[model samples]
Target chain A: MSDKKISKIKIGIINLKTNNLYSIYNAIKNIGYNVSIVETNTKYLNYDFLILPGVGSYAKGMKNITENNFNKRLIDFILPGEKKILGICLGMQLLFENSNEFKMTKGLGLIKGKVKKFKFIQKTIIPHIGWNSVVLNNKMNYFKSSLINKKFYFVHSYVCEPADINYCGTKTFYGNKYFCSSIIQKNIIGTQFHPEKSGKAGINLLKSLLK
Target chain B: MRFIRIIPKLDIKNGQLIKGINLEGLRVLGNPFEFAKNYYESGADEILYLDNVATLYGTNNLSKFVSKTVKNIFIPVTVGGGIRNIKDVEMMLSSGADRICINSSAIDDINIIKKTSRIYGSSTICSIIEVVKIKNKYLITKSNGRDIVNKDPLEWAKKLEQFGTGEIILTCVNHEGLRNGFDIPLINKISRNIKVPVIAHGGAGNFQQVLEVIKKTKISGVAIASLFHYGLVPKFKFKKNRIGNFNYLDRVKNLNIKHTNNLKKLKLFLKSNNINVR
Candidate 1:
C-alpha cells in the first residue's frame, strides 16, 4: 500500500456481455497499465488482478458468467491461484453469497455477505445515487490521507451486508441507514459504487489499486 | 456533505449540441463529444446531456451520441430528454450513460418511475422537474416548458421522491437562460423537503451566482448551460464583442456572443470562493 513503483501491472477485466465495461476499461488503461479484455469463459490467467465489471440484474450477470463457463476459470484463479479480484456494482454483488434482486440467486461466495434492498424509515429515494461521503472503516495506505472524507459516486438500490464487520472497508449513509459501500478480505475486494464513473476521486482510487 | 458537484448540461437536439433561451429559440453549438471531453479535462464533476427534442420528435437514437461521449469522457454522464419508459432507460444505460433523466414521461405515468427504480435502482434515474412561477405559485411544466401541468411544484417534488427517484433536477424554466440567478426560494423549498439529492439548475450565470445558490439552497449540484457555453454571462457582458470564428451561435440562426470563462476557469473561481469542487 506504500508509494511503491507501479510497474508491469497486468490487469485482466473479465468482460461479461451484460455489463458496460468501457468506463472501467478506459480508466485502467488511461493509467498507463496493461489491461486486457478477458472475454468470458476464457482460461486466461496471465495477469496480476482480475476485474469483474457488471451491470443489469444479478441473475443475468451470473447467468452470463455460468453460461459461458467463465465462473470455473474465475473460481480457479481466485482460490488456488490466490490472485486478487475486484468486483464492481453487479459484479460486486456477484461476489456475495446470494442476492434477492430478482430472486434467490447464488453468487461467487468470495465474500460472506447478502445483497439486500434499501429499507427506509421515512420516505426516501430507493437508488441512493449522486456523490455521498464514505467513512473508512479501516485505514489503507493505497488511499491518500484526504481521500477518506471525499464523496464517491454511488448508484444502487441494494447494498451488501458483510457477515464480518472487519470486511467492511468503507460505509456510506443512504435511505436513513449506513451500509457497506465496499468490502475487502485478503485479495478479494468489491465496491457497490462505480469507481470508474466517480470522476477524479474514482480515477485516483483505481490508480492506487495498481501494485 | 462533500464537494458540491459542478455539472455541465449539454442540450442536444437532432444529434447536435444546441443552446436556447428558456428552452426555446434554439441555437446550435459544437460537437457534444468534444465539449464533453473538454469539460472532463477542465474538472467537471459530471456531464448532463439533455436530448431537448426527444419527447417532441419521438425518436430514440440518443444512445449513439451517448456512446461516443462515453468512449472518451470518463466522468458520470446523465442523459435526459424524451425518456418515456423503461426501454428508453435501458437503452441509455446500455449506451454508456451512467444515469437517465426522466421528465414528461414520469409525469404521464408514475408507474414507470417505480418500475425503473425496481429494476435498475433509483440512483440510475433522475427526475427533471421544471417549474414556472405563475402568480406567487411555482407550477410544474413539462415538454421542455411548452406544456404546463396542473400540479404544484412542491407537491410534484414530494411525489417524485415517493416514487423512488434517485435525484431531482429542479430547473426553473422561468429563470433558465435568463442569467438572473437561480430561484433560490424554490430550490430551498424542495431540497429541504426532499430526502434525495436535488441538483439545482437554470439561472446560474457565473461562478458567484453558483456560489450564492449553493450557499442559499441545500442543493447537491449545479447544472449550467449558457453560462458555461458562452463563458461570460451574455447579459452581464457590456461589450459587444463577436465570439467564435464561424459565428457559432448564429449557426442555428441566433445572436452573436463570445465564449468566455470555460469549465476550467469556473472550477477555479469556485475553488477560490471556498466552494469545494472536484
Candidate 2:
C-alpha cells in the first residue's frame, strides 16, 4: 500500500563563479528542495538533481571544466540511473559537442550538435539580451500548463541545439531561434535563463522541475 | 550564451549625467536618472557614473552621487569617483549600488582591493586604472590624470589581480580623447593576468577597434565612450584562433550610421558571411 515514489528530492549545485547555477540554486532552495553545493575537485555528485550555471567565454569555461577533470566526473554522474541535470546559459552550451565562443572548444556530448553564435535576421542584437517567450513544439510535464508563451530572461551570445531534434522540447528566440532550449532527452532537462532573475515564469518552471 | 554590455558613461559634476566630445568637453545632457531609465529600457547592462567634482574639491568621496544613480536605475548601477575609504565603500553599497568603481585610490593602495573585495564579494568593486605614457613609460594618474603616480600600468594591474578584485575596467588615457581604438596590448595584458573579466574603456572609435579588442585580448566585455556616445556602429572582420574564432580588425574610421531592427536579416548575414560591415 506504500508507494516510495513520493520521496524527498535532493539537489546539488556546482560551486563555481559563473552565476550559471545561481538563479536555479535560489529557485530550488526557495521551493524547498534539499540542496548542497560541491566543487569539481570534491566528489559530491550523488544527488537526485544536479545544476550547472554558466557565464563568460565558452572556450575558457570548457577548459576550466576539463583541466580540473570536472567534465569526466559529470558524465560519470549522469549516465547511470534516473538523474536530472540542468545547465544554464553556458552550462546549456556545454551539453553540446563543441562551442564557437572564442574557438571550437569541446563540450560534453550528452547532447548532439555544436553551439553557434546568434546571427540576427533583422538587426536583432547578437547576444539576444532581455526577455523573450518560448513556444512549445509539444508539451512536457516540466512546463507549467498555464505558463505557455510566458516570457523569460535570456542573456547569452550563443544558443544550444540538441544533436537530434527529438531532444528539443521548446524553442525560444533572439535573431534565429533553433535547437534545444528546454530539452527533455529522457532524464535530463535544462533551461537557458536564471530562475532567480527571471521573475514568475522561471519560478513556475522551477516549481515544475521540483514537483 | 554571450551577454554584451552597452554602457553609457555619465560624467557626473555633482551628481548628474554629463556628455561631451572630449574629456574636457562637458555639458549637462539630462537628469542622470532619466537617461539611465531610457538606456536600461533600450538594453544597457549598467551605468558608470563618474564624478567630475573630486578635482574641484580636495575630497573624492562620491557617496551622495552613488545614492542618486542607484535610486534612478532599477537595475544594477556602478558609481566611480572619490571613493577613498572603507566608510565610503560601505555607504555606496548600502545606498544601493550594484558595484563601486575605484580609480585614483586603486593605484595608491592595491590592498584596499583585497579589503573591499573580501567585504563585498569581489563583484561589487571594480579597480579602474587611467593610464597615460610619459616618455616611453606609461604613468598611472589620479584626479583624472592630473596627479601622475610612479607605477607601470601593467605591473600594477597584475598586482591588483593578486589583490583579488572581481574585474578590472582599464581606460587608455592616451586614447581617451583620440578615439583611435582601445589599447589592445594593455587589454591583453590585464585580461591575461586577471582571473576576473576585464572591460576595455575609453577609445573604441569604430567597429574595427571593437573586433581588435576581442581578437587581440580575451576580454569579457568592452566599454564604449566615443563610439556608442557618437552613435556609430562597429563593422567587424572575423579571424580564426587556436582558442576560438573571433572578430578581428585593424584600422578604425568614424562614420555616420543608423540603428536598424532586423534580427532575421542580421542572423542571415552573419551566417552567410564572416564580416559584419556597417
Candidate 3:
C-alpha cells in the first residue's frame, strides 16, 4: 500500500484497562495511521481496524472486557468480517474458547483454541521471556515472507492451541515445545508476541499486516 | 530457538542519562531519549531506563521521559526506580513502559511483588536484585546500593521467582562500571536456581565480556551501560546545563576503552561466536 493509502487507515486500540496501550498507540501512530485509544465509551465501528492490546491475567482481562460491555461491541463490530481486529499477547489468548490460567476462564471464543500453561520442563523457564524467532507458516501467505524467522518480543507463560491446524499462522519454539505463535481466521488475527515492542522488524510486520 | 536479548540500560538522573562506576560516581551523559533512539535504530533488542535517584528521592519522574521516548522507539522498554506500589506500576505502564522493574520497593515489602505480579501478570513485573559481596558472602542491596539487605542473593532470587516475578535483573555492584567482566559464578548460580529468565547487568567493558557472560552463564539477556554509552559519547551533543557530574564526558575520549560502539557490531560478534542473538 502507498503511504497515502496507509495514512488513511483508521485504527482503534481497545483499552481493556489491563494493557499498556500507549506503546501500541505510539507504534500505530508512528506508522502514520490515524490511531486512537478506544476506551469503554469509544465507538467500536468508527475505525477500519481494531487492535486488542492487553497485559495481565486471563481472568482479569475477561472481567474488564465483559464488565465494560466490550465483548458484545467487539463481536458486533466484526460480525460482517469486513473490518479486521488484531489481538496481542494476553489479548490474543482472550480470542480462544477458554484458558486454564489460574482457573478456568471463558474467553471471547472468536476463534477455536484453548489456552494452557507451559508444562514444567528441565532447562526451560516459565513465563518464556525474551525475543524468539517466529517461523511463519509457508502454506498461509497472510504474513510477508520477510517475517519468516524474524524474532519478536515475547513474555508469557501460557500457550494457545487452536483446534484446527489451518488457523495457525506461525509457530515458535520455546523449551522443547513448538506452539502456535500467531493465528489467522478470516478477519480475526492474534499474535503471541508484542509486535509493538519487537523493534524495527515488528514495526514492519505491523505495517504489512495492518496496512 | 530462543534468541538472547541484548538490552541497552540507560541510567537517568535529573532527566539526563548518567553512568557510574560500581553504582557510584555518577557522570552525566546526553539526553536519554537520544541515546534510546540511537540504540533502537542500531538494532538494540530492548531499552531499559533506570532512574538513578528515584529510590533515594522517593519519586518516579521517568513516566514523562518514558512516554516521550516510546513515541519514537518501538522496542520493549523496561522502566525501573521508585516503583513503590501498584499505582506507580500503573503509571509507568500507562506511560508506555512495557515492564516495570522494582528493587527498593520489593525489598521494603515482599508482598508488593506478589500483588503486582498477580494483578499485572508475572511477565510484566521484573525484580532487580543488586548484589554486593562482603566477607565472602553475597548480599542484596536496595536504594541503588545505598542500603544493604541481610539476605543471600541466591535466596532472594529464588524468593523473587516464587513470588511470580516475570524476570530478574541481577546487577553485580562490585563488578558494575568497572567493565572488567561479569561475575560468572554468581550469575550462573542464580540463573541455575531460578526458573525465570535472568538478565545479567554490570561489568560489561567490551563485546568479549558480554560474550563471556552469555556463554558462561545461562542468562537470557545482557544489560550493558558503560560499554554502549561510552562508545557513543562522541555521537551525542550535550547541552550546557548543570545536572550531574559532566567531567567524565570530557575525559571519555582519553579513556581508551576497547568496545564496540554499535549494537549491530556486538550482535554480529556474538553471532560469529555461534551465539543466538537478535
Candidate 4:
C-alpha cells in the first residue's frame, strides 16, 4: 500500500470506440484525475491503471480488440507489473476466456471465465437493463467490509461465470438466476455494470480504484 | 429484482426542449443539458430525449446535446426519434447515448430491429410503441401519430420481443399531455403479453397517476414529460386562476416549470406509495 502511494499514479483509458468513450473520459476527468485517452494505434502502456470500456455485441467488440491488436498490447502491458485493469460492461465480458454472444468468441483470458446470456423462464425479461443492487460475496472479506450490497446500473443480457469461485467478487440476481456481476483476481477487476453510469456509487467505485 | 426506473422524458425539436399536448401545439421548455443535469442531481434513474423532428431533419440532431450532458450526468441516457437504419443507431450510440429508441424505423422495417439487436446487443435497443385507441381497440401508430399501422399492438410487441428489443415504451397517444392518466388497460395488456420490461409513458398528471398505472401493470419504469415539464404547478389550481395564462412563446418564462417539483419529490412520492424507485 505504501509503495503504491509512493509511485506516481497514471491512468489510461483504452479507446474502444464504445458509445460511452467521451463520457467515461469526462467522468474520470471530473473525478479529479488527469487521465489519458490511449488511441488504438498507440502502444503506450506506462499507466498504473487501465480502463477498458465497451458497449455492443461480444463478436464485434472482440473483433475490434483483435483487429487493432489491443488484446496483445493489453496482455503485454499488465503481465509484469503491479498495474491494475478495470473492465466495464462489454469490457468486463472481454476479460473472460470466451463468450457465447452471437457465436463463440475468444476473450482476453485474463480471468478464467465464460460469458453466457441470462437464462430464465418465459416472463423474465432479457437484457436485465436498469439499476440493480449487487451483493459482495462474503468470500472476499475486503470487498465485504468496504463495498456492501449497493445498486448499480446494469444493461446487459450476458454475464461472466468465472471458473473458480474464489475469483467471484460480487453477485447479482435477475429473474431467478444469480450471476457474477464482477470478478476480482489479483490486479484485474471487472464489473458487468457500468460504474461510470451508476452515479455516486459508481463514482465511489472509480475513486476507490484511484486510491 | 431491482428498483423501478424513474425517467424524465425531454422532447427536443430544432435543438431546443419543447412540450405539447397530445404531441401537438409545441412549446419551448428550456436547455436540454441543464434540465438533464438538474434531473440527474434530483435522483432521476435515467433520462430519455426524443428528437421530435428527427424525421424531418433526417438525423439524430440531439447527438451533440447527448454528448454534452453525459459528461456531467452519470446516469444512462436514451435518445429516440428518426432512427431509420443501422447507421442512425450507430451514430446515436457512438455519440454517448447509452441506448437508442427506434419507433418509425422499426415500424418501417422489422429487420432493422433484428440487425441492431444482433450487433449492438438487445439491451442497447428500446422500441417505442405509440398507440392510438380506435373504437375501443388499441392500434399501433407511427410518425408521431400521423400514420397508423393496421396491426395489433400485442402482435407488434411480441414481434419486437422476438427481435430482441431490450424494453418497450408504451405511450398512449390519446392520453398524452391530456393529464387524465395513463392508459391502464392498454399498459396492462401489453406488459402482460411481453416478456421484456415495459416503460409506461404519457398522461402522468401526478405521482398518484403514475402509482395507479404501476399498481395495475407489469411495467418496470415510468417516463413522464408533462408532469416534469410543467414542474410543480398544480394542474387545476393554475388553470382555474386563468390570470397567468400565457401563450406558447412565453410559456417557458411565465410558468414556474423550471425550478418547481423536482425528481426528489417524485421519487419520495413513489417510494411512500410502495413503488420501488431508484
Candidate 5:
C-alpha cells in the first residue's frame, strides 16, 4: 500500500479497561494512521484494523470483555476475515481458548491455545520483566527480515501456547524455555510483547503489519 | 536470551530535568521531553522519570510530562517518586507510564506494594530502594535519601520482592551523580537474592562501569544519569529563564566528561564485550 493509502486506514483500539491504551494509541498515531480508542459500544466496522490492548490479570481481562460485551463485538468484527485484529500482552493471552491464571478462565478462543504461568526454576524470574529478544519463525514470514532476533519489551508471568506451531510467528527464550511471543493466524495477529513500547523497532513492526 | 536494557533516568523537579550529587544539590538540565525524545530516538531501552521533589511536595507532578513524552516516544516509560497509593499508580498509568516506581510510599507502608501489585499485576509495580552506607552498614533510606529507614537494604529488597514487586531499582545514595562507578557488591547481593529483575541505579561514570556492573552482577538493566546526561549537555541549548539552576548546564558544556552521548555506541561497546544489550 502507498503511504497515503496507509494513512487513510482507520484503526480502532479495543478498550478492555485493562491498562493504559495511550501508548498503543500514541504509537499508531505516530505512524500516521487514523486511530481511536473504541469501546464495546463503538462501531467496529468503521475501522479496517482493531487492536485489543491489555495489561492486567487474565481473569479480569475476560471479565471486562464479557461484562462489556466486547467478546461478541470482536467476534462479529473479525469473523469475516477481511478485517484484521491485533492483541497485545494480556490482550494476546485473551485470544486463546482458555487461561490457567488465577482460575481456569475461558478466553475468546479465536486461536487454538492456552495461557499458563511460567514454571519457576533456578535462574528464572517469575514476571519475566525487561527486554528480551524474539526469534521470528522462518515459516511464518509475517515479520520482515530486520525483525529476526529483534528485542521487544516483555513483562508478564504467563505465556500463550498455540496448539499449532504454524501459528507461532515468534518465540522468545526465558526461564530456560521458549514460548510463543507472537501469533499469526490468517487475519488475526497477537504479540505477547508490547510492540508499542519497543521503541523504533516496535513502531516499525506496527507500521509493517498494520500498513 | 535477555538483553540488558540501557535506561536513561531523568530526575524531574518542578517541571525541569535535574541531577544531583549523592541525591542532593539538584541541578536543572534542559527540557525532559526533549531529552526523553532524544534517548528514545537513540535506542534507549526504557525512559525513567523520577520526580525528585514529589515526596516533599506530597504529590507527583510528572503526569502531564509523562503524557506528553509518550505521544512521540514508542518505548516503556517508568515514573517514580511520591507514588503513595493505588490512585497515584492509576494516575501515572493513565498518563502513559508503563511502570510505577515507589520508594517513600513503599517504605511508609510495605503492604502498599502488595495491594498495588495485586491490583495491577506484579510487573507494573517497581520498588525503588535507595541505599546509604553508614558505618559499614547499608541502610535503606526514603524520599531521595533525605530520611533514613532502619531496614537493611538487602532485607528490604527481599521484602519488596516477596510483597509482589515485579522489579527492584536499587539506587545507591553514596555513588549517585559522582560519576565514579556502581556499587557492584550491593547490586550482586540484592539481585542474586531476589527473584524479580533488578535495575542498578547511580554511579555510572562511563560505559566500562556499566559493562562492569552487568558482567559482575545479575542486573537486568542499568539506570544511567550523569554519564549520558553530561554527554548530551553540549547538544541542547538550554533557556536561561527556566526553573532551577541553569548554571550547571553551562559548566557541563565544557566539562571534560569521558562518556559517549550516543546510546548505540554504548550498546555496541557492550556487544563487542560479548554482553547482550539492546
Candidate 6:
C-alpha cells in the first residue's frame, strides 16, 4: 500500500513571476517535499512553508502582489513567523521596507531594509551579471564554506540595504559595495542571488533550505 | 576570465542564408557555410542558426545542415528551429553541433527543456528568445514573428535556468535586421534575470555596438551579423573594464545552493564515477 498519510511536509509557493519556477519546483521535489505553485493553486500561501519568487522589476512585482491581493495575505502569512519563508531576487527585496527600483514603493517590511539603485560602474556594467564572491555578513545559513569564497549569480541594478547588520548575511561587489545579497531574520530568509539560478550549488542550497 | 565570445547569427531558410528588413534583408544573402567559415576565421567563438520555418513547417531536421557546416568549420555550433524532441537533440549532438535552441516547444512544454538538459546535459540546450517590442515592453515570438507569447523574456529566462537550460540566445525581433543597436533594455533585464550564459543577437550595426551591449549586459557572448558585414574590425574599441559573465556566476551558485553536504563524500563519489561535466 502507498503511504498516503506519511506526514508529508507541505510547501506553498507564491510564484509572483511572469514565467515558470519549475527549476525550484523540481529541485524541491527531488528532496521529497511536495511543493505547489501558490499562484496557480490559490491555497499555496497557506502551506507549511512558502517561497516568494520575483523575476522582473521591483515595481512590477510589488504592483502585481498588491493588485492581486497577494500582499495582504503574504503579510498575514509571515506575521506569525510560524512558517519558514524564503525570498529570491525581487522577492528578497520585497521582504524589506521599500525599494528604489522604478519608483519608491512600499515593500512587505518584514525586515528593516530598503532596496536602492546602483551607482555607475559605467565601464563595468549596469546589471551585475554572472557570479561573484559573496562576503558573508555573519548569519548566512546553509553556508558551510568560507564567507570570502563562493560565487553566485546576481542580476540586479538595485540592491537591498538592511538597516541592521543582523539581517544582512552576504554582500557582493559591483560599482558600490551594497549589502543584502542574502539575509536571514529568524524564520524569514531571503537571497538576492538566485540559488535557483546557481546550478549545482543552487540545487544543493534548495536542499538545505528544505531541511 | 574566459575569453568573452563575439558571435554573428545567420538564419537559414531553404538552404540560403537570410536576413530581412527587421529579420528583413529583402533577399537571400549567401551560403550559411561561407558565412560560418568567415566568422570562425574572424574569431567568432560560435555560430547560431534559427530555422525561420521550423514552427511554420513543424520539423527541425537541421542535423543534415549542421553536419555539412561542421565539415567546413572547427568550433561549437548552435542550431534552433522546430527542436521539440530528444531525437532531434541527438541529431544535433551527433552531427557535432554543440547546442540546440528551443522556442515554441519550450513554451508549449517546459519538460522539453528538462528532458533534453537531463539527457544531453544542460550545456547543449540553448533557448532562442525572440523578444518583440509590444506595448512598450518585450514579448517572445516564434516562426518569423508570427506568434507572440505574452511571457516576459526575463521571467521565461529564469524558469529556463531552473529547468537546467545550458544557455540563452536573446534575439530582439524588434531590432533584428534593423541594425540600429542591440536591445539594451531587454539584454540587461534578461541577462540579469537568468544565471546561465546569455548571447545577445540582432541589431549590431557596428563593432562599437557589440562592445556597448557587452558592457551594458555583461552577457557571456555578444553576437553580431551587421558588424561582420560592416567590416572585419579586429580590436575592441569600447572601455576595457571587464564585467562578470556566467562563468563567475556559476561560482556564486556553487557555494549558495549545493547545500552544506559532506564535501569529501561528494567529491569522492564524483571522482570515482568520473562524472565531471564542467
Query: For this target, which candidate reaches the highest lDDT against the unseen true structure?
Result: 3
Candidate 5 per-residue lDDT over residues A52-153, each given as its tens digit: 988778887888888757688789888889999999999889999999886899999999979998985777877887788888775766576547757788
User: Model 4 clash pairs?
Assistant: none
Candidate 5, position B112, lDDT = 97
Instruction: Point out where model 2 deviates above 4 Å.
Output: A1-211, B1-3, B20-22, B55-74, B230-278
CAPRI category for model 5 = medium
Residue B273 of model 4 has an lDDT of 82
**Which of the CAPRI classes, incorrect, acceptable, medium or high, describes model 3?**
high
Candidate 5, clashing residue pairs?
none
Ranking by TM-score: 3, 5, 4, 1, 2, 6
Give the whole-model CA lDDT for all candidates, comma-separated.
Answer: 0.78, 0.62, 0.88, 0.82, 0.87, 0.66
Clashes of 6: 24
**What would the DockQ be for model 2?**
0.04
lDDT of 2 by residue, B85-161 (tens): 77777666555455678877776667788777655445556778877777867778777767778888778777876
Q: What's the residue-level lDDT of B24 in candidate 6? A: 45
Q: What DockQ does every candidate get?
A: 0.41, 0.04, 0.86, 0.71, 0.76, 0.02
Query: At residue B104, what lDDT does model 3 achieve?
Result: 93
| Candidate 4 chain B: worst-modelled 10 consecutive residues by lDDT | B236-245
Off by over 4 Å in 3: A1-5, B252-262
**Per-residue lDDT for B1-278 in model 5, tens only?**
45688999999987878999999999887778878888998889899999988898798899999999999988899999889898999889988999999999888889999988877788999999999999999998888889998899988888898899989999999999998999999999998998889999999988898989998898888999888887777777667457778778778767755544657778889999988777
The model with the greatest TM-score is 3
User: lDDT-based ranking, best first?
Assistant: 3, 5, 4, 1, 6, 2
TM-score of 2: 0.52
Cα miss at B171, model 4 (Å)?
1.0
lDDT of 5 at B200: 96
